[model samples]
Target chain A: MIENVCLGQYIPGSSILHRLDPRIKILSFVIFMIISFMSGNIFSMSILILSVAVIILLSGVPLKVYFQSTKYILFLIFLSCVFNVFYDYGEAVFKFWVLTVTLESIKNSVIIILRVTSLMFVSSSVMFTTSHSNISFAIETFMKPLSIFKINAQDIATMITISLKFVPIIFEETNKIINAQRSRGADLDNKNIIKKVKSYIPIIFPLFFLSFKRASDLAVAMESRCYNNIIKRTSIREFKISILDISCLIYIIVILIGVVYCEYLMI
Target chain B: MSALDIKNLSYIYNQGTDLEKIAVNNVNLSINDGEIIGIIGHTGSGKSTFAQMLSGTVKPTAGKIFLYGKDIWKDYKNRKEVYFKVGLVFQYPEKQLFAQTVYEDIAFGPKNQGFSEGETEEKVFEALDFVNIDKKLLNRSPFELSGGEKRRVAIAGIFAMNPGVLILDEPTSGLDPISREKIINNILSYHSKKRGAVIFISHFMEETARISDRVAIMDRGKIKMVDTPENVFYDYKSLKSINLDAPQITKIVSNIHSKGYNINKKIVTVEKGTQEILRLLRE
Candidate 1:
């Protein structure tokens, strides 16, 4: 059940999105998110969704994976839509005791669902195309100017990369621990809330201990190899911008302008 | 009825995804009560997945698993009961220990089985005796114990439940020779006292050969053969074909037999090999 989550997980491929500059991908993801929020009418929203779909196809990652990443957030989106349907004040399409379904509310709910879903797909598409190390490196490059404010970009990047690497490892460890506990007759499926929480104690303690041991061992391994923060790090894979990246950026800017214009016309 | 019966059992991981893999495939086997079955296979030959399926930890993607002629997954509510009946001791089980003390850890299983306080304690002590753990160490934290001791405590945790069939997956790997022997002995003693079926999975051919009543060879997610040690070891060619080797003694005996020696080629244990070679020399 835990393995189904594909959010922030990179799928290795050689597609155009995979080969694009990580900086440009991150920048485009942010811009896409802004455009999705600004997209209000059906025309702009459909345009945003269509472009995201195209980018997802270009990413060479399966559409199922992106859907899986967004599946967990579907409940949140549904809740917000339900709230908008009941709470919004406008023309009543249907009336009931203490409740009314308004045409405006229906429009708001549709826009909310489309906006949130498009945002989720865009983010998951970006993550599926970019590896964790590349993402961290891009962040480091973006934060390099912060060094003037007494910040260490490389250290922050190393931390992010290590944490991202640990996510999968820790997930595997948790699964092992859960299986082990289950084998020992731990009733993890108890319906009683208190009992269920208590069952996790066995799993949590071992996971915490294992994570600490791993972190300390990793630190020792790095130190043994003469790792020092005082020295600047050099990466083997250097980021270089290409014409494809520039074209992709320009395409995103055009989309941003179109979305803003549509929102202005709607207002 | 057999203690455990698996028919056309198969498990596919990540089904419908590109990462899909057939971990266990259309496997069939039956283990009798009071039997010791050794399963040997390569690293990715689906041995662990097969073991998990038998112990009811993993649900089979296809086919059925029967515990004493009853389908285990027939009713979801009874799954926990099945788990208690078929205990699994995973590789490096010591990592599973999380109780405040060794006693508490061993008692966890029996307590889960809903035994009373007195019965839980008795079962815990019995498990300790079976695994040869000292009573004095029961009060000590499981984390404070040495590697071998921690392993024994973890095994004892399973034994306290007194499962009808104990399935151990590579239980002795990464341990010293002495520790390995001790664990094997503990398992043997537990089987003798409980008279329960045992499914032992291991890379060490000699240990499996020494303990198993019938050996099952697995390859590519299928059971290639299930036969006695004598027959399985005698046919070394088939075992090697699946990237598995017979016990060292069996190999040496076969080598000696190939050199025109009149000794039996099916010797699987050191003691039996020595006796056969001594008999050949005297003749």
Candidate 2:
């Protein structure tokens, strides 16, 4: 019953992006975030956008799926761009009824929109290429230093992966609950918001009940499988950063340097 | 007059996409009032999809369905009436019970149809009585009921509406044999008492053979054959080719017949086979 959306969807492929170490992918994502926030000029924004496009193309994820991933948030990107336009100080190109469109504002707004889209696509590409377990391992590796500070890194990573896995299960349970209520003639077609909310009681209550039941069953199953946290846990597939992954990281670093320094030169 | 008339009904899942599947293919079927038909098929054989389509839950991509000589989907506005006329009991329906009390859960369908409060209560009581749910359990929370009791309450919820044609999809799955037998008996009593058509969409060949007046054999989205249980089980070879097994007794009778014994291969149920064997021994 769930629509196939690109969000959190891992596309299976043997592309370079897919084979990259999860640590490298995760590290690269942090670098991308820093660059996105630090980008001051259109040049930097264009560099980030182009890099994102190239990585997506190489990741073997269809362009359509990437767009599908960003489709829902396009409205938010547009809103932020419009908000950015109003906050800019520049010569106005168009003005009407407390709304002003300026050349500088339009330029800044374009960069903002592109940056948001780039951020969304960059993260989605990582998700599409890297499986959930790999990302969890990456998170654990990155947070290893925190273990010295007494943080329970293993438990945190296990929790994140479990929550990620349960997202689809919750959706399925919700669908079943909705269908059951609907079959009993639950009137979801009410115009009143209160009435609609009331109608959802049948769905919401059952969903919560069923999910709790599933969670308990899962807890039992995990216990039986000996999923208790250990001091030194070993995974089936070891992640190693290869030359290909390092080279890709180096190329991204080059783009970051260009984005930062070239923007300074332009200013 | 037929209680339900289905003409060339078909449903396609994920149409116009790479993952598209013909869940239900062109199928023409009709059920008479008070008739009981058990549909047996393997997974993905379109049995459940056919039941969903018949109950107006899933719209058919092609052809038409006429309930009591009226096109059920002709106007589209009468969908609620259609739903009421064709009640559907989904598999694992017990998980749907969210009402505080079993009585309220059973009254949900009747109340949804805008029955008067008294009338809803009357129907609920009658349905509870029909399912043999003790009146003392009516006021208790549905959550507190045993698994079999909960399932009976769920079935009672649909029974309160008293649909003209009832459809149950694998109702007795994942239950003990005694519970399964009780549920089957309850279904039979309900079907017989209401004089309403009942369609059992199931994978249990033995259950279907024991209960159904007519059997519909489905495979790969098509209804391959429909006939009396004895007639359908007579040709066990055709059934096996469709990835279906005949009832155990029928197979044993067929095996005996193949062994030079003049046993009737059509004796599907245990009682019938035993009686036939005893008669042959007496001769």
Candidate 3:
């Protein structure tokens, strides 16, 4: 059974990672992603993976949550390995009928798997720790430079965060639609792929229609609240970067330098 | 045989997690054929989950639902068959409407049951008339109908299936008094004519009192009380303990009964209260 892991929802903790300024966390995630892409050697990537594991442990979430977050990307990782396994140019250490296993292909598969894991881990750590309000604040602050190009950064942040907030609601609405259709004798458990896809039509239409209605209702509510584009926005709570955030940033810079050195100057 | 025999029904949400909560627990209830049972509870009291389980939309964690002495989930085929045996009209049923026209929307259930095209059309028209919707509006888009009309059409869709048991969750919610009356009357008429059980769930005490033959009060995951409307309302202290209310009219008559009149405190609807008050005046 495919687990519906609660990966994207905030876990609500007051650990050091959760208390960091939203801007600092966002900046660190960006730098971490770049480091992940640059660290190709086994030693550097191993260090990167260990650092991400430590971050996950420090986020006050259990190890199961880290694995649960990885479950969603497991299929993609498997697919990438399957495709890369056949591209063998190195010495074939083992041979079977139309199947070849080479040391280089094996290494490539390991690196691909590691990259995917690192990508998910670094982001999931931050995502599980940060609240929706903080995320929007971080994105808005990070995109301030885009305002000079005639873009409404705040509105962009609002739209993104609103969509994120509606993700769970959409899942709940879809489940309700599925059950409603099933009660009407709409059989969705057929083994035939075509039949199963066709069975989803009755559910899809109602869900789409309901989402549009909800959107209009939300718009009306926002209008009633006097939300306008022209007004200068104000936040109820402001975040400040503390000493912990500075130390965390310094640690990230050290790892970033190690990754660049390993990629370029390693003997 | 009972229309439904639910034994030791329990449902836990997010089980085994920190967020685990008992949505419904060890609930036992039996429904006779054609009996209208109104389930009343405060929000989060598990009425909806209980109703959903009855319709087989939700699976009970530790219970069995028997329809007419047959376990509905005995096998996959029987479970699929039972899906049609207990029709569920979810809350805000109007939002489930998606067909191009009212005729198509009302025909969806019967058509899914593999009724012949002619039979499906017949049942659809019959259900329309059952709900007091005019056949002239059959071809109109469901989006074009008024809110009350859409609601009726949604219920009529389920009515067309002609299930042995019908469960409607909050059928008259968010409507004007007259529309609410019409919808309730429509459901009552359908229930009376078919002689099928109807499980009505609502937070509105008066609406439940007006329609249901028996009212079941739910509190925190269990059925706190189940009796006739008169008997249930008589236990006002227990009802208040669960943060529920008797019908407004019943409360008024009961208040008068407490103050000094020979008023019948079991009165639920306004019309009944008025008649009782007039009798006291004439005396």
Ranked candidates, highest DockQ first: 1, 3, 2
Output the worst ten-in-a-row residue range by lDDT, candidate 3 chain A.
A1-10
Q: Please tell me how candidate 1 rates in CAPRI terms.
A: medium
lDDT of 3 by residue, B1-283 (tens): 7899989999998777776889999999999998999999999999889989999988888989889988777744556588788999998888778889999989989988999999999999889877999988999999899999999999999999999999999888988888898899999889888988989999888889888899998999999878998889865767888889888788888888999989888777889899999999899
lDDT comparing candidate 3 with the true structure = 0.87
> Tens digits of per-residue lDDT for model 1 on A1-267?
224664677778899999999999999988988899888887798789889888988999877777777787977898889988987488899888988899999999999898888888888877788889999999999999999999999889889989988887888788888998997778999999998999899999988888998999999999999987898889999878999999999989999988888878556
lDDT of 3 at A180: 84
Model 1 per-residue lDDT at A159: 91
Docking class of 3: medium
DockQ of 2: 0.45
Error of 2 at A166 (Å): 1.6
Better of 1 and 2 by DockQ: 1
Can you tell me the CAPRI class of model 2? acceptable
Better of 1 and 2 by lDDT: 1
Evaluate fnat for each of the predicted models and list the values in order.
0.65, 0.39, 0.63
Q: Which should have the higher TM-score, number 1 or number 2?
A: 1
TM-score versus the correct structure, for each prediction: 0.95, 0.92, 0.95
TM-score of chain B of each: 0.98, 0.97, 0.96
